[model samples]
Target: MSQMGPPRPGASMPAEKAKDFKGTFRRLVSYLKPRRKKLAAVFIVAILSTVFAIVGPKIMGMAITELFEGAYGQLQGVPGGGIDFGVIGQILAVLAGLYVFSSLFSYIQQYMMSTVAQDTVYDMRQDVNKKLEKLPLEYFDGRPNGETLSRMTNDIDTIGSTLQQSLTQFITSIVTLVGILVMMLTISPLLTLIAVVSLPLSLFVIGPILKRSQKYFSSQQKNLGRLNGHVEEMYTGHQVVKAFGHEAKSNEQFDAVNAELYDAGRKAQFISGIIMPMMSLIGNLSYVLISIVGGVLVIQRAISIGDIQAFITYSKQFTQPITQTANIANIIQSTVAAAERVFELLDEQEEVEAVTTSVLARAKGAVAFEDVDFGYGDNLLIEGLNIDVEPGQTVAIVGPTGAGKTTLINLLMRFYELKGGRITIDALDSREMSRHELRHNFGMVLQDTWLFNGTIRDNISYGKTGASEEEIVAAAQAAHADHFIRTLPDGYDTVLNQEVSNISQGQKQLVTIARAILADPPMMILDEATSSVDTRTEILIQQAMNRLMAGRTSFVIAHRLSTIKHADLILVMDQGQVIEQGTHEQLLDKDGFYADLYRSQFSAKVAI
Candidate 1:
């Protein structure tokens, strides 16, 4: 199949081309370290197979020599002058045995090599997956999902294929080259020298092509990842594209990336393609050289006609490996390039280790952010920010975009590390607690409700593993979702498609609320949970949320001022700092930033 186009943002393109070809080659080979036993066995079998094959040409030469001697004796009217059928039969039988052994050994070698290659790839894939899990969200935030996926699939697959095919070919080619050289020398050193002379010329033709092709192959893999990223992004946001009338723009961008990919692929293939015919041309030239030289040796009686025939066969065998080695060299370059990409992912910085044994049992929902300072990177968004919330207090945070509203929740849940100060739950430092235990204390319902392709019951119960049916239905009822769910054709048993388009957005939001309700944590975060629903559905959801938040500490991030009007505390924020905090009446009485925002929204609603 053809490779993909220009890279996706944050896709697994090489950060830089691998400058150390030998180092990358060594690291790629090291993946086989764990399978050394199988590899060693494969090597031994390969050697045995090559040895068996090498004996055939020499034996046939001997058989021909025997026939020539017998015929000459028969012409002299001497004893044993006629064809020696017995000797010929013995030689033929040995040849058949050699051929059979060679085939058997070759099969065994291939089986073992295949086992080693697949097992190594399995280990690599496992390590990459585990590494992904351990890596911090920051690493992912900087990269495209499709790029990482391409590395996981396309790059690893390339390594596996190269190992399966090229590895065996490489070993066989080397052994065949050496063996043929030895056999040719035994027949005639002069002919062997002629065969040896072609090796440098073959390298001369291959070296520059291999060097030039490496960069293009690397580019091809990068472009493939880029192409995958584009497709994934366009398809994932296809609705947005249509709404914005961006289909033509999307196609134009895709074509641009596709054209670059095609160019890279063409250049890579074209450069590498030169190796085969060039090698073949050199091989043919070597064959002709050996033939002429061997014929002279035969005419001079320095070597028998049988030896000349064997030497010519050995010459072809020698050149064949040289050609194969050139091809394998190109494959190795590609494999090494792919290996570098995989290793780059494997080498990414992982999240800071957490205290695995720390547990927060029955958290009372008291949250404190004491002199907390934070930033996405170096911008220093939140500096010396302090907040204290009593258990069961509803804190509604209102801010323009990029005001670090969500960053507060991210820090509370330990999704991102705090740069300064501490966050405490109850009386204990959150950093001292395990992330799982800390996060378990809080339940979140995001604006974009995510529902998996499963039954409604399954999606709701996902929040609490092993939740009983009774608990699921109770949570759904509390979220006011049970009635709507039961109205469906299959009720709670209704299976949602991947997009969950079968249900209305309000219903989807309700299901996510039900999931959070099922978790029933002491602390909750509602990020614009009711923003997208119609007025009637919003009322129903608000009632459900009010009940859900009655005695729990809640953090509500709402753009609509009306939903948070009854909050115990409203934090009005801008540019990562809280500009005002109070109830709706107090904020309006102050006629500050919060009042302005509320008035603006109220006026917009009035205009509507």
Candidate 2:
């Protein structure tokens, strides 16, 4: 078991700044293209809602002016002097109607925008999922599981929430700003000028805060992803950590990541949080100036008192949108950062799509590797490797660790593309056949058994879709797992937990063997499939595998030399090339590498 190690230096450092903000933001907006109609509705409805709400203060001012004039006439004992409550009632009715329509349209806009947001993200998630499926295996091999998961879940979620909430707020804030500005200018340009002065001050305050907070926002997102990755890794491997007594070390690493996240998040929130209060203070100062000027205009009979009342209201409303737009800018900045991460995943190099000029419905299982050259990166792991297998031959590959045994299987199954030469199945080029067609012809049982959280029957039936109860039971019996499976409380219906720890290791191997048996493909690949069982269970599994491999082209990667003594052809591999190839007796008679390895293992067993 491998123990968890400390995080690499600078692992918690803020991610590099977004490289293409405009490009990434534009791409993010493209998801909305499909829902442009709905988005258009949202935009128009937002404008209408703001328009109605914007007219409210002006209309209410009329009522105030009517009451003021009426009260003054009554004080002068003029005829028909009393305040006209009837006219005020009519004004209130119209005002109520405006508010009602404003709220209704606001709700409509919210509903429409939410759907658009959800639909856009739905398409984005679908695209990300499809891209993941098309990406080459090397992408996964080079990245951490948790890091990839954070991109899929956390990063996408950030995009979703920003779309749902911030996008609509952004639309409404702009419209509110424009509408309130128009309403204020109609009342008095001088007071409007006083109100507009606050705009520059507000911007001055917000500029530095935004610039300072933007990096922290980016850092906050990056550190959050790192923290998620760390937590996921530690939680999943907690058993190993405990067994290795690395709890203290794991905690130390966690603390380091957590501390970094806290620092970034605190700075980001604190800086962005200053925008609102600063905007309010500036708005208050502008309000004082607007009031003094408006009061002077009203005293000079240059403007109605009611108009001054309405101008004050408009000034407050004007500054609000500016504040909101600043906050939304911060939010959009963070959203774009998240979108860039998702786009990076989407832009990964995909596996070369297979062009099927020849379709093999049922292969004869004659697999051949001719002059094959391949490597993970630059250094060739296997060069000029040639191998041929006739139908119905059991070929066992024996090699030390890193001897290219698994790489051979990976190439055969088309998991990785060959670098120099081509592989053939039934005399047809593997590349000419679709990967789906090529991989479907083989069933594999690896050292690490994979079983999902489902019933035993479902897991077994996974090897062959729609496998009947009889077929599943027969396959289990063939693998020698049926007897033990029946002893459990739920028998075939027993659900495997997520970890599949309900059963012993040997039992898990047996279940996997049953799954392969049910598959019954034309060829089989077994990678130390029986290595996890006891002696008796190993013998049972070997017998089951022998039966499974009969009359089928099977490749077995065996570490224990004794297991492949009966194989028709045994290839002894070292350093990515086969050094010897013959039957067990022939190799022993030659007294080559195979003989030395066999003797060593036999001697070790005897000593034990």
Candidate 3:
């Protein structure tokens, strides 16, 4: 459905390092600004949850100490010495209540954060969609459609998932780290120091891995977009590949891109994947050191048995959040990479805003181009070109490829702004009107037909919203599509598949012609509209177009010279300039470029 262009130079190069990671991250965080109240509530709930969970170990250690002391006293034959069931039961109940409240608060925070995360991404997607709409057609023309689609689908999905899952976890990890550290210090500063010793070591091991993996993560995303683009392009044009026997070549290209994607993905995962194990190794070493030191302190009676037990638990708890934070840091790195891509799209130059200074209630269909200069890039394709078409006249543009026929239509429709001069409809400068208003007065039927997945009737009615069923049928009849449609099982109600392959090529062309007829605009553009049909169908379509063009200014771009022999005027164009302009017969009589082209076509037919 989309035209594929050559990949831009260096498209396959490894993605560049993120120029401003902090800036991108700040922009990403700004999305949460709108939900500040919800975020505040989530933070409060997270703090409460961490606080409750942090105190559980200390309270449980009290129960353990009571049992240990009682048993020891009994072994020493002390009077009235045994486990205190009543006190231990009360302590156990309090511990259970703390855990229950902690879990409840955790659930509350998760639910609130989930809503905040979803809403943030929803706004991001909306903004991206609007940004795309405002972007110039040149943007789409310069890149593969799948690359853009990837930003909308794959890249945004990555952001959404990270916000939903990782964001809350990041918050909880921070709170837990702080709360557990405080609790450990209360028990013993010595043990707290031992536990925190792993923090810097974890950072040391993680920093280089993150730094090295950042580029790979960026490369992985870039190559993934390229891979998607290749697949979409190949899939849509699979029939062309088969027709031209380029299956092997297509496979080679796909395999090469797939291999690149695999390489980038593997390296990214491998590099970032090292963080967790390293953190765990350092954490386990810290745990071993804390245990040995804790036993010596217990022997010296420098710390109570309950305090030592709680301190060890806090030591384990301390390292866990550090490990989690490290892992999240890697995830955030990847997410920021995705955000950078999306931001790149959002930052693309948009079409100039429409400055509407004039409005046409109904155009008279008199179109003119004066001193026009335009091009896709810096080099002009049409320079100082001019043309005039009167109301109710059909102007035929005949040219070789790259002769600027389509460029003329693009300028007329205001798809691209002119570099010099002006084009006017009924003497109204096109730039003075909004694009929607300018395009509303013209109907176009191109050689490559477009029909979305819908019933045939719906496709025809797309030209004019709210078109009556009878009007749709009338338009179809005028285009000579009614008969073939009725022959189908569902007739007008027959649903077109995604590719619209259920209908013949001729039928598809007829359907597009019907759509144009239904539009009934003041002007029409037919670009080789009958090129896909058989001779009989072409003749029928030409007749329908003749009726459709009555009393409307029409521009027809044709390659077959015979098709435009009777036009009111013929402009023979070459190298972005009109070489000859006259009635078809008058040009035939001139024995010039037009005459030579006509005779060559005639001779070829006769030879065949």
For each candidate, the alpha-carbon lDDT, in order, equals 0.86, 0.87, 0.88
Q: Across residues 1-608, which tens digit of lDDT does each residue of candidate 1 receive?
A: 01112232433343356666888888888888888888888889999999999989999988888888789889999975888979988998999999999999999998888888899899999999999988876677666777889999999999999999889999999999888888887888777888899999888878888888888888888888888878888899999999999999999878887887899889989998888888888889888988887778777888987788878788878888888888888888788888888888998987676665446897898889999988866667789888888899999999787777887887888878888999989968998887778888889999889999999999999999999999999999999999999999999999999878999999999999999999999999998888788999999889989988989999999998899889999988787688899899999999999988888988998899
By TM-score rank, best first, the candidates go 3, 2, 1
Which segments of model 1 are wrong by more than 4 Å?
1-15, 66-86, 354-359, 483-495
The clash count of every prediction, one per candidate, is 6, 0, 0
TM-score of 2: 0.94
What is the alpha-carbon RMSD of candidate 1 to the true structure?
A: 4.3
Q: Compose the digit string of candidate 2's lDDT tens values, residues 1-608.
A: 11112233334555767778889989998888888888889999999999999999999999999999899999999998989999999999999999999999999998988888878888888998999888877676666677778888888889989988998899999999989989988998899889999988889779888877767877777777788878887888999999999999889988988898899889888888888888889989999988888888999999998888989999978888999899999898888888888899999999897667998998898988899998867778789998988899899998788777887888898778889988999999999988888888999988888999999999999999899899999999999999999999999999999889899988888898899999989999999987777999899889889888988999999988889999988988887788899899999999999999999999999999
lDDT at residue 30 of model 3 (Cα atoms): 97
Q: How much is 484 displaced in model 3, in angstroms?
A: 2.8
Judge candidate 2 at residue 120 and give its lDDT: 81
lDDT of 2 at 517: 93
